[model samples]
Target chain A: MKRRTFLKLATATTMSTLAAPYVHAQEKKFAGITLRFGGWGGLYDETIQKYVAAPLEERTGLKVQITAGTQSADLVKLVANKENPPFDVYQADSAYMVEALKADLIQEVTEAEVPNIKRILPGFREYGEYGVPYSVFTYIPIYNSELVEQPLTTYTDLTRPDLEGRVALPAATFDTWSLYLLALAEENGGSISNMEPAYSLLEQAKSNILALAQSTVAMIQMFETKEASAGVISDARGHELRTKGHPIVSVYPPQGIYGATSYMNVVKNAKHPEAAFAFLDQMLSDEGMLGLPRALRLGVTTDVKLPDEIAKDLTFNTPERIALKKKVDWQKWMADRSARIERINKILRG
Target chain B: MRYDFTDYVLIVAGAVTRVAVYALLALPAALVVVLSFTSGETMDFPPAGFSMQWYQKAFESEPFMSALWTSTYVAVIVAIAALVIGFAAAFAINRFDFPGKGLLQALAFSPLIVPAVVLGIGLLYLFAWMNLIQTMFPLFAGHLVLAIPYVVRTVLASLTLHNRVLEEAAMNLRASPLRVVRRITLPLILPGLLSAAIFAFVTSFGNVTVSVFLTYGGNVTLPVQLFTYLDHSYNPLVAAVSSIMIFVTLAVILTIERLIGAETLS
Candidate 1:
């Protein structure tokens, strides 16, 4: 036999051998079927394809087709075709999941449907009925260590006069602004019910904020150029920027971190329920749990042993960290969102 | 020209403003092209060093290549489809005086007035109601709707500029109506049709907002892919991919120019 053919055979054999135990009866039943997914795009899509899709496909003979789009866009598509959704499974972040549930765009998932739900931590179980919280990310204040003389402990610190003209914040139109706003509200003696205090603090911080970034990429660009020495960003993003050689440290406030959870949901009237369940279950599996966090530096929903280096960076699923995660009542947050947005826009834009 | 201090300050300020505005518009694109050649892992503006590894990585990746192919073919199809429909409509509007000529013209140009996000959502619902959601039909149809207006406008302008004397002369002879149209009308308007085709291609190719709504099972265009990529992560790969996208668009334009002659572009 040719050397290339021999190597190919050996590689295939090793892979199949490794993927043996994951090949369950359900996966066998769903063989040759294609399961469509609407997902968070970019590297996340690659991560899913590499870890979740490949293994699931190998085990089940099922193909996973991930349609790359934002969570809000996915919901719009679902509402447009509520009776017949475009995908079997889709992703939604914390804010939009409420809208998805209220609109009945996604159906409920039982423990039996996704057995891995038991592995999920109690703190992340707020919306377990509608979807599975596969990953947990948080909004924390990240500051450039070289530029910041004193580290940021809370959102209030971002408005300090010393950091004036060196701090960047998300623009009103950016979706992630809501997540940061919740952290400000909780830390500034306000709740989801009342956001006046948060707006008052933001009014004061106007002088300090150098730029209102139009997007996440713009925020990161601000940091790279030292135009933004301090800002409120997600722990995942902070970790990513750190990896990319930015001299920033993510600070977990004494109060708590604001959770920005990502949920995986089976759409209402999904074309392939069995395959969808199997995919969701695999995501919560030991290997599956590692797949997501490894890619984005996010904390896993399930209690899977992570490598020492990664475990140190993650700020979720642990007892102390979970307690530190302050979640907003998304239902209350969404109500009068436009009015609230206009109010903040005035404060920030001023 | 001897200038006073005030005049000198104004001249300097004017030059400075021009340079700043130019840089503001051009720098982001320039930085992407530069970063695509970076040896570093991240998207550093000045670029840590220089390399072609990212370009190599871009070609190897399946998702980007697949998206590129999808964008190219969709844009090409949309451009051709727009041209055919546009020619017919423009010809009718130019030659005849219909009852609702003004209204029809307004309707043709209305997509430009409506925001893309609204149009995208409206089309999504419309396509869904028609039971044409999952197929690639929505994507193609949505892009076609967006591209048609530019096509109609361009073709109309071209039709208006043509010498009617040529077509009349053809008719004055024993030539048929079809013969006059084919020989005189089409040949005179080739450049306009080319311009309209290019406009349609650009409108369809660079679309993101509507494409986001119309994406079928893993069938996404290049611009939407880039937009979605930027949403979740930041890296040199994005810069490299963007550079590749620029190259692809330029190649399409150049290829068309080559086939139709440089005068078509002019």
Candidate 2:
């Protein structure tokens, strides 16, 4: 009887030990602390705070504080004080990520740290080691449906006298340079490998364009505010406004549009890295993407199966769309361009 | 001043010329204000239609309202503090013989000469080191740097106008120094203080560069908010709000003018 009783106690203890990790895993406590995060400006940050931060804090007893518009320069400045990272995690655009990597301002995360790695699309794996691609958009042509029945297909369309002073383009050189290159390539068969022809086309486009907006929101204003008949904007935003009963429609012209992605990376010496990783893991998973489509009106992340309407409008995996994206050589592209952009800006101001 | 036919033609011609010059100056502001009311689909020179929808939208937007309030609050506080501190400093420099008075005057107005971006960077570092980022204190301090010059100039001008004999007369009557200053000096400078405060308030209110670097998202001031919005979207909504601001400013100026009368205030 004594032997049997002892064996029962041993089995019960073993069962409790096994169940403990499962219960602990369910608790969402990462190193027994909350997370601090930072992100770029706009709707994406809003969605994360609304759906992800609040729910995670409730479930895990780990509070999450979000700071938006915290730039990469802020992080680079903070890295010297290794003991405390002002932000436990922050989002960096690809160009900013390149700079961060060079400065050793962000740490790398292996698959072990983020088990949701397999959920991301293969195309996104390139960015997953040090950063994870959170959102994507194509810089496609957006036009007023009332103004044009047919899509504005090529860069040359912008120069049409009828469309002159009505067609708006992204004003930023970073945003428009690739389009300029593509315009040059189209002028000479198909490839923007050189710079001289691109400049000529850009100068021409500059002369023809009505206005340039820095952000999609700005471009949207060109149409909504009646500043321009049409503009170049992310396809996702175009579809979003259309869904909202706006007159704007995103057009995927015969020639492909430039594709861009926004990413979130871990700061090198983030104080609450576990919290950061937990938030990152959540954002990468199917659970996190649930809130974005409705709140932000952007296409879902890679793991998300595009909703029927979204899939129809978005060119997420289209081969042609992928091919047209010029590899962003920020060094070459942004080189000696600040002054040039300013000079062009001055003429545009006139 | 005898009237003649040539004189009548000259008078008419002068009036027309005056009208034309005023029209030239008014045209830009009028155009911007007109754009504010437009419901046109594009931000073009000649708007398609006139509508107050943008103004309604701006009023409804929480961010814009909050930013407007924050800017107003900060401007008022900064104006009052700057006037007090700056008037005192200016009075001391103008009235008393003190060591390094010239240096103090230069330092007080130095921010006016410095580039706004440089001032932003310096203040950012100073505030960060002191662990005061995201607070109103730094913003107030920065605005003071911009505002003190106006106060100094106005107060110094006021001091230059009043004779030393008034104070000497009060002293001769056996009145205390503090009593003489309160009765004689302060009353004489009240108008100048009021003028300086108004200038400081407007300067702080309309500021962008210094406010932009200093602002965090939650604490976005009005000009920064407008600038960001303008960067992303230019429409009649921003124009409408701007027009309202211009009207309000004009109203304030008119009120001041009526109270003091232009010649006396000057």
Candidate 3:
């Protein structure tokens, strides 16, 4: 072979090697696809944009358009647009997931489509194949340590004389209130089906209750204002308060803490199914799971190891801690929630 | 010079009542504005320290800013639409009599009598059936329905207070019907039109119950955004947003007052 021919071939090989990565990078898997994600706004949406959407877009070339709203609002929109759903993927709490499933508004997800589903811890995968658990939070007793003399070790402490007119309980409409009722019932001898014991306990503690907070934010305000000395609150919120120098401490009662999981589901008639799956897959990834604890201080379902600082505050990430989480039959609880809530209202008002 | 015990007592009672009403209305807004300046992370009365950090956050937030823009855009459209339709309807009711005139007048003000939540749900269902729930059109339409009644009521009140003799005299002087409306009738009712437009704008801007059902796909209004924010986080950011709203609303009221005098509203 001639020297000129060899030199020309060498230059061509070098040029192709440099250009290959650029060419591959330009060929995006979801370049043209835009996935519509419906979920809670405020911090949740901000965290999702920072952690999930931005990263997913960079990885797969998928563009995300977020529609922020309450879970019920999103569900209403989904139901309203059932024929041509506006959102490709919707994130909702477990209770609302049940509603979505019953209404046939969401599609079942598969491991093949979302490979990161395998990363979630056992039992965290909820709604069968219809939904995947993204974040988990445990509701436990939280109190301002400076205000309460005695350290609360169990849910029964809420009924103590010292807590009278100082305890802040979640309103009957809040998800945490139902979990608190279940925990109270289980601690006493009643099961999930029979909330009589819970109602009785609440009736006894009625005089102690300062207020029934309408929301988690309201619950936090109760603590901030010193209106509440002790109350039932989420572990994540408790951690957040403590972090903000609020003197609050979260206690996982010996009776066990109740867990609430937020699930992500694909709409039944999603316009961009593949892009939706890509987004869900990112949520289950190690990067995705870790973002929850980092951004929102919430627990993740995936087995991704958390940083020591974040892990210390989480209650359901470890095996021993997971064992202490009490699982309520949410489907059963939701089915009879209206009557239970009415009974609770009567008990609290009694 | 010779006021009796009952007269003095009644004067004192009226003064006390006026003061009480003013305090009741102004105190909460004043409190919210004060709380907006808190340096602390959470909202608390007599806030820990004074800072404009929350206002900074409010300005920096994309969701709040986007909702603010959406609200302003929609309100302007609603105000214009309500003004045009309401003025037409009010003019017809005042100047002409037709069959079912009573029914038409009743329908014009029916939204005010109907419960907002019921109307919201009804609109939601209707929009859903029409496959129009996903778009911002429903929100605009819902707010227009809510705001039209105020427009009609105010315009009708203005028409009643102002004599039609000027309009009749103008028409009798060889002025065309449109010319009378443009020159005489419109000028006399200009203040009422301004009042109605402001009322409609504020009504559309601050609405939540109806807008809540119609909002979708990143088209949330500011009030709904604030409401949803309360579900997860409690911070001075909400207070700051609210303060901005109050200030903007005050500015609008002041502008209207400057432009058309406050007594025009009466």
Interface RMSDs of the predictions, in order, are 1.0, 5.2, 1.7
**CA deviation > 4 Å runs, candidate 1:** A1-27, A173-176, B1-28
RMSD in angstroms, candidate 1? 6.6
Per-residue lDDT tens digits for candidate 2, residues A1-350, read: 69999999999999999999888777866535757666443345557876777667767767765543345335543443334455677666555666666667778886688777657665654444778777665666667878765666665565555676787777656543235445545554654346455455556656557777666666665676667777676666676557545688665555545555566677766777777777777777776766665554555555576566545666554556555543444434445456547755665665
Instruction: Quote each prediction's TM-score.
Output: 0.91, 0.75, 0.94
**lDDT of each residue in A228-306, candidate 3, tens digit only:** 9999988878887887789998888866888789998889999999888888888888887788788768898888988
By the DockQ metric, which is better: model 1 or model 3? 1
Rank order (by TM-score, best first): 3, 1, 2
Candidate chain B TM-scores, in order: 0.89, 0.86, 0.95
TM-score of chain A of 1: 0.90
Supply the TM-score of chain A against the true chain A for every candidate structure.
Answer: 0.90, 0.80, 0.93
Per-residue lDDT of model 3, residues B12-57, tens digit only: 9999999999999999999999999998876667898999999999
Among the numbered candidates, top DockQ falls to 1
* lDDT, candidate 1, at B115: 98
Clashing pairs in 3: A165-A208
Model 2 pairs in collision: A218-B232, A225-B41, A226-B41, A226-B42, A226-B43, A227-B42, A227-B43
For residues B1-266, what per-residue lDDT tens digits would candidate 2 score against the true structure? 79999999999999999999999999978987888777874455687788888788878866667777888888889889988888888889888998999999998888889998678667866777777764677778888888889888888888888787888999999999999889989887778877888888887888877765566425667776676555324446777767766675566567777887787677
Each model's DockQ score: 0.73, 0.14, 0.61
Residue runs of model 3 more than 4 Å from their true location after superposition: A1-27, B263-266
